[model samples]
Target: MFYRIITLKTTKEIWQTKRSESNRILGIVNNVRLFGTNFSNSRIFQKLLVIITERFETTISSLENINDLSTIILAELLNAL
Candidate 1:
């Protein structure tokens, strides 16, 4: 989980709006939060309202699948087990 609040010059009106935006953003994304913005009434809001999708996990190998072990090492591991 992560949260960020960029600070910039702002008035009270925009502060309330961004607070609501934070909840609305969390409703859709699993782990995220947003606070006041540096700019109001700008396209930054639209850009921020993006999915920002990307790969979360990558393929990794575990000891159960040690397919590239040498014969001697394999024998040693089996004997140690």
Candidate 2:
């Protein structure tokens, strides 16, 4: 049915949006990991954190939507820093 098709399309769009957001968050986390200790002092890293918080309305704790691997990596990086 047309309604079912529309619902499926909407679901796909939502999934894509979540995927994009997760990728963006993962990239930021990787960058932080690469910076290591320097990340805590870097102005750019601070800005990225602000952006993540403000734009995504997400904190490190709220990244449960991301995959397990990325979540683990982020957790390790957080611990390291």
- The candidate maximizing lDDT is 2
Writing each residue's lDDT as its tens digit, candidate 1 over 34-80 gives 45434332233233223422210111122224433323232232222
lDDT of 1: 0.33
Query: What TM-score does model 2 achieve against the real structure?
Result: 0.41
Q: Assess each prediction's global lDDT (C-alpha) against the native.
A: 0.33, 0.48
For 1-81, candidate 2 gives per-residue lDDT tens digits of 223235555777756655665577568756767867454333443455466544434443354334333224443424322
Q: Indicate which candidate wins on TM-score.
A: 2
| RMSD of candidates 1 onward, in order | 21.4, 9.5
lDDT score for candidate 2 against the true structure: 0.48
- What stretches of model 2 exceed 4 Å from their correct place? 1-9, 38-49, 53-81
Error of 2 at 71 (Å): 14
